[model samples]
Target: MGDNVVVSNMELEKLLSMKGGKGEGSYANNSQAQAIHAKSMHHLLKEALDEVQLQDPNIPFVVVDLGCSCGSNTINVVDVIVNHIIKRYEASGLEPPEFSAFFSDLPGNDFNTLFQLLPPSANYGVSMEECLAASNHRAYFAAGVPGSFYRRLFPARFIDVFHSTFSLHWLSQVPECVMDMKSSAYNKGRVCIHGASEITANAYRKQFREDLAGFLRSRSVELKRGGSMFLVCLGRTSVDPTDQGGAGLLFGTHFQDAWDDLVQEGLITSEKRDSFNIPVYAPSLQDVKEVVESDGSFAINKLEVFKGGSPLVVNKPGDDKEVGKALANTCRSVSGVLVEAHIGVKLSEELFLRVERRAASHGKELLEKLQFFHIVASLSFAL
Candidate 1:
């Protein structure tokens, strides 16, 4: 691994320590979301596995979930694969093959949290003897490997099936130029071209392209010949380069507005804003295909963008009044963390109150414009 790719043990410890705190926010609910994603990915993988079994009856199967935060998703994936293998065996009148699972994530991921969630051998119905004899089943989890999906993390032809959800969009880090707070074009809290110049926008685009290319290249090596990979990540739509009235605009504007408010309140300095960039990039569907094809090893099986509605609206069990209350509660939970982290403990209460007032004034208008895309891409290629 290159120096930039290395994640030290100390850094991993620090990240894990920060895993469950006021600022954790949506990340704390990753387990819940992973379960939902696993359900969707299961069918896709089963189909791929069936295709593979048709070619080789007693082939060993291995599945790897990259960027598997805390390994919650890994367990669910393993459950699905095991069930699928059993069904495949019964249908084909052949014995089930041995299976191995690997969970890969940033060195800083909370592996302890993941391992704690695992059930002991008692949870597996088969006795140790039966498990050993009937199937060569093994499951393993590892962390702190690295974050670059564009680079090879595993040995060549090692992974049989690769899966990731909601994790691929995170760039390794913000572009280096953006890290310099002294740049004249820097707009601390805003990401849109309104506060930023065309140059900044183009710079972001370039960095995104490089990152996307790297992600595809890395996946090419690990996936075995004819192995399948699945990815579901945030995506954006292509607008006229000049037209800024879309999902990207809305998300950028909201985050920028929030940052601007904090800056005006003297919670975060202008210099800090210039130096910080949200480490997320939602590419268009065309952009995604371009990057994947650039690698030349993978063929796209499906690429569909589905909107999951506005991310801001919180719906809970209740009438309109109760729904509003639930929304408020959810917003408070989110804003509270943002305030404490981006602002400070001394101003967290006041900042959260101000944010609530601002949301009350414009939340609905904003939600109408806000959109999230769920892009699922399945790929297969020869070794």
Candidate 2:
């Protein structure tokens, strides 16, 4: 922290939210990549459930999705969990437990849109009013909780299973030293620690460590004994923080280039570009293991890194341009709001348009180089 550390966590919290609504630029539409990644963890999810000691049928089986942005992917995850639980209980000739699925994210998330998408199907929980009336027959009750996952969001030992996907990479706040011009770690000309100087990368790593520690501490308090947690997050293959091979780094480079284009065109000042940084970090597996081990609340039953599947890489005829556009849209859906906050709506639109163009132009090359590292882990309370 230095004199140049003017940006506060509160300011970042207010500004940093995914693109809301169901438009093309919205996170809901652009989250197919996330769905693809989540599907890869289906077996792990089952394993987590098998390990968790189920509560009596009378006590509702509580499940919470942290950072569950507005999308079908969120619902799909819950659907998978609920279906697995029911199947397991049914096969054993036991009554399935009542379900409560809580979708959580920042307060700015499009919860209304999320609620609207919740169908009355057997798998998808019906409306709260109807669920109450049909309590005995209803599959689950759905609710939305708005808060940061890095802090305590529920009462002590209230949650049975905690789930989060594609969320933990987002730091609670940008490291203060990186934004401080007076500090050696000041990340000039780069919007992320990716490809930045070692000092700058170290600063971001430190912030991630602190944020994750806090997250585990809070979740440990909220999770009941014998509870389980399943998490999937963006990560890097290389232990080095500056490794530029991960999909997150690729996306960061594209965004930084977009900012460079704006700076070069004289539409936005270099200082303006320098002032903005995404509050995200792709940790290595070692980084995550260290945090979990140090927290001492949860035992890591499974921790492995895997590559994204065929869905991420397009092989269709003449679909390179579409692939590029989709990747650009995904990037914008996640980071556009923050960009808009920093550089205004007009330039933000122009900036992402440049991203789309660049991605479309080099679609094949980009797709070939797209190595998205996904870390999936199952953890249970240590005692």
Candidate 3:
């Protein structure tokens, strides 16, 4: 009967570790988009890493992959980066510096599951010094920093390469104002803002501004001059938030439908339904530029839009079941826990099932593709 998003981003992240889409896990079922994106962007990632090496040579190359979720995709991405840096220097007739790769996420992230997949977990809540002890060049060291990227996590000018993918769209939390019943911004009957209302859109945009500002400011202090940051996260095609054709809107419609079923069954109150909002935003390119330019910490090298949905939406349009599975898994990994907490696990499952079925039935109107703004930057200044 209360809003599940009332908690802070730190708290939400803690609750999500168990629910995070992990390798060989439920959430992983629909992360093909993320996996593909990682490999596809290998060249981009390498270019950034290579640039870092070219600029700063013979020093420990500290690489941080913020929000590094568990699985082979991360491993493959890290492997490419590690091997590239090593080979680049080797080909230039110089010894490769030690590579210290830091995998960061919230404290609640499944570090145990993640470390077992890559580096050994020598200890909990590790630091750079401890991570360095275990790292060897041919093998590089790996450490996990468990906390919000919204805050500064590394020392000033200590980082060389900063990379985040499929992350950053998650704001620290839903803008608190969206919950006020008297506020016109109240996103009634919607599970996410998704540009459903102008007030709601403005509220989300404001939150994104502050969060991105904090992120850029912190990273500016942490990275050296000319340091590179490659970010690939979900973003919108235009400045308008009300574009209703994206997957966020379509799936949210099904989420509402799911809640409607529960309301009919007297399982949840309309007040509760109207009070909730997802703690994330798919920002526009303009939004990112405004934050970065205003911060005066980085110079934009390149920015591009990436398709947000699995290409399968177009390739297998006739196969509703397959399309449904993709969309369902994506929704499940993101909001499964929130739904279970507020609406009950059984109803949560039913909600997604209803969505899957609905997707299956309306194969034609189910073209809910989304996109991301892939922006590349180099540190120009710092706070």
Candidate 4:
């Protein structure tokens, strides 16, 4: 948009702050998604806690949640874990150990908002120190750390559990090759890794390998032997990495169409559009398995792929305006900051506004058809 407009080092983190102000508009979608998906994993989650060693009655049970965004969406997952652990203690007649949980995200995450929202009721019987004091159960303590999950976040062998959801798909950064003007891998129109050049595809694959490996390596160090990590995140289809079966049908086509319209309106430069791509990669089931197996740190106990669930906050199912606004707000939460960094704030807002209009036209039926393949893995540290 201007010579002054450049991608700052902190821009990505700022973008993830969710609509910039301390408002509810941006984080509404991720919060909703977390609620829906957290329920689906209830059965698998319980099974994961079951595998975790419970013999020690006095030691603190530590759990670290990676990419925990700024709000109750995070608490929802923690509630699930604590609930299961409570059940385990009850069944075994074992003394409940102190539960220390850490919520981690990029330095830019709105952890202030996260902390403000952490009332006991939001914790699902997990966070109220007083409530637990009256009983025999050990208290649950929650803390926030700001950092990237691709690097180490805690001391070696100190953690008992690690959980990440809807977050690992993000690569550390977009591939350098795609943005270089001199490079052959210039992504002309699309924003994602799908349908890119061989060079671009290979670059993404290589980056994903390194990122996933680093993620596993760091976690392996922090997690004790027999510790568990349960991850639920986006994954590509078996037949094709780009085609998410019908998921694209529900949401992708409309999103692209709206962006194309913005280009036609001369809002965003073609050069900028071509060079800009999301830093996310939804790896295939095979891709995830290979990386986990090769890491030699964690033994895969369970790997299940399933679709996304219904919208939580969005009331009406098929209402075009409501659906469109919900979808637009969701994308705006994660990508809006980055878009503004490159295209200038005005155009970025306009772009997603158009996306809302476009999404509304698709109706809820099509949106429901959107593909959301998830990889729910219960991994144990290799002893």
The lDDT values for all models are: 0.54, 0.81, 0.68, 0.72
On residues 1-383, what C-alpha lDDT tens digit does candidate 4 reach at each position?
44236564346554544443355456743466666777777788788888988748578888888988776777777867876887788888887777777999987777877877676533334555564654444356788888888889999988888889888877887777777778787666777666556677777767788899999989988888767898987776654555544333423466566668777887766665765677777777788888999999888999868776543246777688988887777777766766677777777778888888987887666555655677788999776
Report the Cα lDDT for residue 281, model 1.
59
Across residues 1-383, which tens digit of lDDT does each residue of candidate 2 receive? 22123345677876567899988889888777778878877888889989877677778888999999888898898888887888877887888877888999988788888888876633353554565465344467788888888889999999988999889989999888988889999889988878889998888899999999999999999998888999988888887787735645455666678889999998887877788888888888889999999999889999989776422434462676787677678778998888777777777789888887777776776666777887888999886
> Lowest lDDT 10-mer window, candidate 4?
243-252
Task: Please give each candidate's TM-score.
Answer: 0.73, 0.92, 0.85, 0.88
Ranking by TM-score: 2, 4, 3, 1
Global Cα lDDT for candidate 2:
0.81
Off by over 4 Å in 3: 1-10, 21-25, 53-58, 119-138, 244-247, 308-317, 364-383
How far out, in Å, is residue 337 in model 1? 10
Q: Check candidate 4 and list the clashing pairs.
A: 247-370, 247-371
Task: Quote model 2's TM-score.
Answer: 0.92
Q: What lDDT tens digits, residue by residue, belong to model 3 across residues 329-374?
A: 6677666766666656666777788777766665555654334334
TM-score of candidate 1 relative to the true fold: 0.73
